[model samples]
Target: MEGLEIGLNGNLVDAETQQEGGRFFAADASSSNYILLQCKDVLTLEQKEELKRLHVTLLSYPAYNTYYCRYEPTELDEIRALPYINYANIYRPEFVTEAGLKDKLENSDEGHQPPEEKRYEVYISLHEDHRNRLEQIRQKIIQVLGIDPELVNADAFILRAKLQSHEIARVAGIDEVQRIEEIPRLALSNNHARVDLNLEYIIGAANSRLVVGGGLGQIIAIADTGVDDQHEALRGRVRVIEGSRNTDARGHGTHVAASAIGSGNSLEFGPIQGTAPFATVLSHVIVDNAGNITWSPLMFQRAYNREYGARIHSNSYNVSHAGIFQQRQYDGLAQDCDRMAICLPQLVILFSAGNSAPFKNVTSDGEIESQAAAKNVITVGACESTRPMTRNPLTYDYYVAVPIPGYLALNLAGNRDQMALFSSRGPTKNTNGGPDDRRIKPDVVAPGTVIYSAKSSQLDLTLPNILPGAIEAGVPNDGRWSYMNGTSMSTPLVAGCCATIRGRIALQCHNLARIPSVLVKAILINGTKWMVGTNQDSQGFGRVNLAKSMVCFSNHLGCGFWPKQESDFARMQMIQGQELKIRVPLPTANPYPDGITPRFSLTVTMCYLDYPDQSGLVDHLSLKVLQKTRLPDGTFPERYGNKLPGEPADNRNNVQKVIWDGISAPAPFQHPDPFRIYVRVERLARDAQFLHHFALAWHVEEMSRGDAQFDFWNERMPSTDARNRFMRKD
Candidate 1:
């Protein structure tokens, strides 16, 4: 016991408990013992085994050198007496609250319950390994707090319960509880979207039999208020996975659902086509009639549901006040989404970056909060539409214009090149509670201003906070089609694009399982047309273009999932310094029109689902394309993902891209050189046992005639509708 220090505390200590000298003292042994144990060094396997032998269970080590321990109160002193221990203090839930809240709770009137609205409904996350003990902990909390039994809902890793201000601290003191977060009431956010995204061109190509299908035989899952499955455009293809289609009274979800896969005509407009007009939609109604929403896990429940067969999930809603607790809260929806991604590696999840741009208190002009800040999710933002608004010509400008004092507003969403005023921006705020972290958010943007799509028949179009005489619905009297705007419109459109790509892969690769989510993500991002003047924080990797993305895939080397030798993709476990190389052949020179100077660009993208951690990224790999031949200057030409040659490698993001463009037509014809793709792991999660997995996709393009080449490639490629495991059997 040379360097050991021990103190005592139990589950029922109230505000009156003294906080002197790193101790809270002990009470009765009615509940399990939870001690915040800290040590100078990380505990060894033998040391951990010794504690287990003493009947003490180590819960989790979130940050610092501290470990959460559960044991009988009698064994506290005995464990503290062990040689490796430093300080074993009582776990104080009150310490988690902000300084202001601590003061308010500590100095408040006794027997006082916070206001109804202030009594937050929160999800208490338990230690990952303690999931089986969730019910036991919840029952203990119910017995101790005497709360109504109906208010709690338990899952594999979380317990959802409504708690008053004082009860938050008491719940945190539970032995198995890891963290708590207030459930956010998500708001709807969506589109001249089809034209802006070049969906019309892709659809036309597919009709000509130039491509496999425009998202044909694919499924996209939308988790929103609800979808109007009976709507003319979405009637046959839309299936309700959670809530009924008739429940969409807000019209937001119906409009969003249509933006992705709607296939019929609008009442006013001739044809209201979605990005993926042929793709099926699975609707998960997350919002209730009273406008309340479930916690994060329930919001994305269907991503892994085999019956839904939805590999792509598009959510157009986000927390009302975005970024307020983003940096401070590590156990919020963002963490939940990250954990979900780890569990379901093939699921592609997209979230709206929120419509909180006008409020400085919400955005702080930089971070997007909650699920939008999740590392594994593709956070989407809004860009102005190129086509004119149908109902009100300048509605985009009117809603986004500077508002009267005390209200949130900004002037940014009019021009096609500019970002929408209400679209949240990002250089995501790191989790301040743990390690330093930051990543570029709003992964991509699409035209989201004054978009027309299917509207719920039962929806009441009237909403608040509008200009005195402005119209609420874009189409004044049309019952079937309505126009709306926001990242919500853009998100589903992107999801449709993902479905299109994934669908094509499923059809093209006859022998594989579902195309890896990372492969599709890489291909979509790799083909992006970078907005020359804008930075990554606002526009991400630029707009999603189907024409450009289709051309990004190799014409010769096939891209397929794992276990298929015909596929160009590779998925392997990598450790620090472990490097894998792939040789991506460029398209052979093709005869072009006389005056055109043909240019070729080789783009490579790699993505991996990393282990979840406090520091946004748990695993990182660097992508670089190396040329075989050395230049006359004795330096071999190389391009790092998103970086110029000779710069240091990027360590920030999980998705990486390297584009080697502008090679003269003669070089490929003369040399036929293949870009040497190198993927190397830089680091792994703390608990990761030496290895992590990743997927890599590469393509070579003839930039001078990209569309012509896209059509040509599709015409030559074999076409079939090979549905994967996620396809609905019912």
Candidate 2:
């Protein structure tokens, strides 16, 4: 039981003294113990060995080269057998300082600390071999400081370990595979040439009146190819981080920046404007002309370190192969990596899920590395939209479908109907042999296929780059103001949306913290759409429907299924009295401003719990409303009241009840009000389940009034034979 104690300052003492005095064991420097020797100016291995023979174990040395140690009274073999050595220097003075040691010593006052400056005392485990050495070091520190060694405690320090950059060339089964092109021969040339702008869908889904500004007027660091600061869309929005020579020679950075928050006119040719046009862009060009990108976690940290309030960051460029090795020494410089602005809660760093696809094992190399893989950041993926092209040559216009005889489909060419095979997909699985921790990747998807956005004409207009071959393949006239596709293209869409959501939430709720990244994610996921045949993995949640999402949030519509009531109170009154029955009709369809489908069943139930005067009078009245009903003006009312009314409205006379069924609908009902009801209530005040038997019948209606032809409702009809049968039978 004889153990040695070591301190952070390299002081040591015997185990018995440590236990009785209250000192505890701390860290082990055996792996990097040489770091301390070098700090002490012990140059030779022989000198180090000689010092070791003196029974002194060297602890860590501060940056100032101060060496500290403790003496291990027991032999190395004996020390190795002890369960734990007592170390002293690891104790945090803050805890004892903020809350006086006397208070902490009182068992009754254990949890009673000041609200603002609370602290916790902790202990760290040490290897058996290093136990005595660490203990000895602790004692020496107490001796040097001349403090009561017994009062010493230990504090746990978490080391910031950087993960190596992982590169995957392709995502399995998704990348490089040509999506089957359905010939655009609808037989109607007018329809073929004329694209549906679908502006109604966009306008209906989004609330144009609610503008969410992004970020402080402060700067956000964007590591990408050089941004187009001069471009009208990004002109005032961008603030180039000076001192760093990084510039977007490749134009990738510009596209990424534009996607993040390009405010240019949506009417102008090229792609649509970004999600957060009002947010300032801090452009940090990281990609060069040769397609060589020089970036590290350190570079991003340095950029943001200079500006603290810069809460937003977008890194579209990544190194495929750079990460921290487990055995490597990352004590100083590497530890500083966590101090990066991106690591802070206020800053939201977004990265592209990566362009590599079709090979699940491969990704955009460093795209999933630090910062992107960091716990707090948001990662976005791309989704292809089936929306037709908008042609307004005066404002902005382009062909959205493929021209005859072209094989390669470049996004800029305006084929919005297809998804680019290269856009990355993920639930970033554990890559380094460990637990299968799935990093929720691609928080949301956005229009990435054939997206027309601002592009740098400088790169796109040059020779072969914009030649017939390139044009035939669908590359834009120049990289500028051209269209592009990839998760890179998709990520900024979500980032912009995030800024918008954050801004609006902050303005309206005055509760910014309530808007966690997860909620922002929920909005986007809940509004997305799956492709013709893909599942959740390919089209996570759905597309980013900012307008619909904002409305849902405003209305307190959560992601869970809508609440249901077993019985309709309105129908129960009829069964309580023996009176003449009256009929109410139900609507065949739902009526809401927005033509979205209801996902659950609508029902109403009525029960006669108690009989009048204990007479036990009950009646099973089956009443159904005719689908047809007339208003005072003789025109059909929007819906039929589905329930029946009994005369002698007073509660003592008679009672009636009705129950709505879980009926499916093959096609949505056009109108949603004046629903009819069917009632069959038996006298059952004594029966517990009788109350459950009663149901309410009301017409389900859409909430918004806008053009319905262009709505996503076109895709909501039931196609399953079983569901269709259920709907028809009902």
Tens-digit per-residue lDDT, 268-355, candidate 2: 3434556666777776665545445544444555555646334556656332322321111111111222223214324455666554
Clashing pairs for model 1 are: 8-25, 190-485, 190-486, 190-489, 191-451, 309-726
Q: Which ten residues in a row have the lowest lDDT in candidate 1?
A: 721-730
Total clashes in model 1, counting residue pairs 3 or more apart in sequence or in different chains: 6
Q: Candidate 1 at 399: error in angstroms?
A: 4.4
Candidate 2 residue-wise lDDT at 83: 30
Candidate 1: regions farther than 4 A off: 1-118, 202-212, 242-245, 322-331, 359-365, 390-402, 405-414, 433-436, 461-470, 476-479, 553-571, 587-599, 631-635, 664-673, 686-693, 702-730
Give a tens-digit lDDT track for model 1, residues 136-182. Answer: 88898899889888778786457888887768788877666756665
Q: What TM-score, over all chains together, does every model reach?
A: 0.78, 0.45
Cα lDDT for residue 349, model 1? Answer: 85
